[model samples]
Target: MTISMNCKRFAILLIAVATLGCGNQNDIGPTGRVNGVLTNKGVILSPHTQVVFLHSQGGTAAYGGTDEKGNFAIDSFNDGNIPIGAYRVMIQPPESQLGAEDEPSAEELLENSNGRKAQKKDAEFAFKYRQLSTSGLEFEVKEGENVFQIDLK
Candidate 1:
């Protein structure tokens, strides 16, 4: 009976230590929680759309995925906050929807032998921000919790 009690106590102590090591949001210094909604002419974006924020000066980048309602929250490593910086944003779709102008997969995107092949569904009907340099959507993320409603042109 005494041995069982000791084991239980040991397990509790181990769990407590692990929980404490997980850290809290307040512990993340010089970072901010970025929450935003992706919109196009006041309409919600398609589900599973991805957003990328690349630091203009380089070295840091943040990514987030949108839901059906177009809401998204960007965080570092699924736990920490994104470092404060000016980022050029790119709101993109999945590979199957890439079409021709943006090229194909990783290997195809790198090659320049051909320009455009297939036509995209949204090529003319809608606007798609796919390139880092041409996204034209710039945002500055500051400290603490930052929120923005990004409207794509």
Candidate 2:
């Protein structure tokens, strides 16, 4: 009977230590990392583009032009206040550089600008859409790395 009691206590201690370790393993830094590639079909993009991370509740996070190899990373530190929900990802090719020629020219966009005056703008720019193919996707961000590979076809 004494030996049996000792064995049970050892087992309980082992289990408690394991549970504590496992819990601590997942508690990483408050900052979450997001990384991925953007591609259309099999070819990687050549010019610069913009990537936007939009929360369902109207907040946003933005990452900019990837390298020639088409890779991007965005790291953000939160107070862990992000609500659990779906988030929309958006991509916008820079007005100065785009894949297609028929696309509108950035010069044309600022033609009326005096270089010091504000132009008409709204949430549309924040959620701007460059082309039908480059629109963002929706993803849920947990407490770890959120990787997203976008395939616009």
By lDDT, the best candidate is: 1
Number of backbone collisions per candidate: 0, 1
Residue-wise C-alpha lDDT for candidate 1, range 1-153, written one tens digit per residue: 999999999999999988887678454347777888998878887776778887776457778888889998875663647777888888878555555564445565456466643334454214437777667888898988889898876
Q: Write the per-residue lDDT of candidate 2 for residues 1-153, one digit (tens) a residue.
A: 999999999999999988776465434334345667877665676546666666666464545565677786653344323333466777776566434443335765577466532323421232234432346467776656767786655
Those runs of model 2 whose alpha carbons end farther than 4 Å from true positions after fitting are 1-31, 75-85, 98-136
Task: Please tell me which predicted candidate would have the highest TM-score against the true structure.
Answer: 1
Quantify all predictions' global Cα lDDT against the true fold: 0.73, 0.58
**Which stretches in model 1 have alpha-carbon errors above 4 Å?**
1-29, 78-80, 99-128
